[model samples]
Target chain A: MGKPPPISNRVRLHRMLAGDMTQAELGEAVGVTRHTIIAIEQGRYSPSLETAFRIARLFDVGVEDVFGWEEQP
Target chain B: MYQDLSFREKSAWAMGALALIITLFYLADVQPISWRTGEAPPVDRHFIKIAIATIVGSIIIQSVLAARNPKEAEAPADERERLALARAGNHAGFILAFGSVAALLHYLVHANGDLLFHGILISLLVSTIAESALQIFYFRRGG
Candidate 1:
């Protein structure tokens, strides 16, 4: 397995706040697969800039509110 | 397990299994003849049979999978799936290059084109299997 990306996201939390949206629903809204959403939430993948914007827009938040850079020591 | 897997992952597993079975069958059919004659067996009816089997089997397997998951099968690969596939292809390309080089060296040493042909063919088969395996790995590991 590859290392997880040095990125963090609140997609799962935001999904819940947004009427408990399911990963599939979020993925469908964002034009990605549910698996891709799962990977993003798990920190296994970093979304493209376009996807990041889409996700943030879907959640009614700025990209920075949804995603954060995890500083490595 | 099957239900948990994505369509692409399931396809990879199925194709990998098919490739493995075909490789074993090809070796079983040719190895005995090569042992008896003390030489690489010539391309013959057995090769043709294997080729036909591979083509037909691939079509059937793909059709069955698509039937089971029509929407997913019809959708184009997403970003992550594409990345995993490209990475698998990169690694498999190395294996193919190494195998081809080894086959060429063997042909130079033994002056046997037949063995060289079989060696390259085996490399292609093995690399295909490896590519599928790697794709499965990437899928499972969240790549």
Candidate 2:
């Protein structure tokens, strides 16, 4: 299994706060597939700067609010 | 079981499976004849038939898939999907080049023109299948 990316995200948390938004719904809003959202939430993949900005914009949050750098152990 | 997989992922799986099956069929048809004749088998009508069938079969499968999910079929691949495909193709290129070099070396040693042709063709088919399989793997790994 691949190690998780150093980036971490609160996508799921934001989705819950956004009136229980579904992954598919968010994906469509952000021009990505549900699987990409899932990967971002699970920290298995990191999005490009554009996608990151889109996601934050969709949630009405700053990019730093949605994503954080995970200090490597 | 694969319901969660995206349409592109499903297509990759189907194409990979088809390529593998076709490669097996081609080898089965050619190997024994080559063994018996001690030469490259005659370029048979069967080769053309199989080539056409493979192409037509892929188109039919892809068409059916697109009919089932028109929107997804029409959507272009995202950045991650494109990256996965590019990486897969890169690996497949290495495989094809290695196979070609090996085939050339075998031809130089055995002087078997028929085997060289068969080897290179098989290499092409194998590389294509490998590319699809690699794409599936990358997609699942979070592309």
TM-scores, all candidates, are: 0.96, 0.95
DockQ of each: 0.67, 0.69
Question: TM-score for the first chain of model 1?
Answer: 0.96
Give one digit per residue, the lDDT tens place, for model 1 in B1-143.
Answer: 67878889999999999999999998998899889987756578767877898899999999999999998899888888888899999999999899999999999999898889888988988998999999988876776
Stretches of candidate 1 above 4 Å error?
none
- After TM-score superposition, the amount by which residue B118's alpha carbon in candidate 1 deviates from its true location, in angstroms, is 0.6
Model 2 spans > 4 angstroms off: none
Summing lDDT over every window of 10 consecutive residues in candidate 1 chain A, give the lowest-scoring window. Answer: A1-10
Query: How high is the lDDT of residue B107 in model 2?
Result: 93
Error of 2 at B108 (Å): 3.2
Can you give the lDDT of residue B35 in candidate 1? 92
After superposition of all CA atoms, the RMSD between model 1 and the true structure is 1.2
Clashing pairs in 2: none
DockQ score for model 2, please? 0.69
